[model samples]
Target: MTNDEKVRSIRSKIKCMKSTNEQGFDVIIWMRKRFLQSEAFVKNLKRIIDAGFIEKWTNYLNLQDISQRLLAREGAIKDPEIKFEEIKTIFVLLLVGHALAASVLILELWYSKRSRKY
Candidate 1:
């Protein structure tokens, strides 16, 4: 079949498989099912990739995010560089939470000791 025909076929099949209220998470679940359980779907998708038409197909289907995620899942996409600043921010927040808890405990201990002396 022609590329346009294939796209139509894929679009119809996917639409039928999807729920009316489908969102990003739903699409991920659907894609996982398609890849894992539907041999014909996987074969067609492989053909699209092999023919260098994956971008076209994904764009046509409004599945750019899903395609990127699929590539990431398959390890075709490399991991992004880690940001030390983000990690440092998280660490600082955790430290602040710990300090708050420790302060609360110390206050409780001091209150208990002062009460005992009264």
Candidate 2:
């Protein structure tokens, strides 16, 4: 289990991936498929986050302000620095990122619209 899971488990154990309908303590995953601790086994689970996902982690880890600290932090597997020479590689990365964003936005819009349709 990961640190987040350990935190949750400390808070009376949520048995993993079981979500609740509470606020502040909820992880609003929406269209985002993976989180830092998300494992490969959790494939088709939609909006996967437990009731104790946030508070449990925050308190257990003493993060206090994890959101502000980790605001847009990212790293590369091998090449940490960006090379200006690989224009095609950069373009491909941009394209993939944009496509993923567009897909998420479209999914959100469609889901919202569908909810309204009911």
Clashes of each: 0, 0
Point out where model 1 deviates above 4 Å.
1-66, 69-76
User: Tens digits of per-residue lDDT for model 2 on 62-85?
Assistant: 443444345535432243675678
Candidates' lDDT values, in order?
0.61, 0.49
Which candidate has the top score in lDDT?
A: 1
Question: Model 1, range 78-113, lDDT digits (tens) per residue?
Answer: 767988986998999999999999999999999999
What is the Å distance of residue 105 in model 1 from its true position? 0.3
Pairs of residues clashing in candidate 2: none
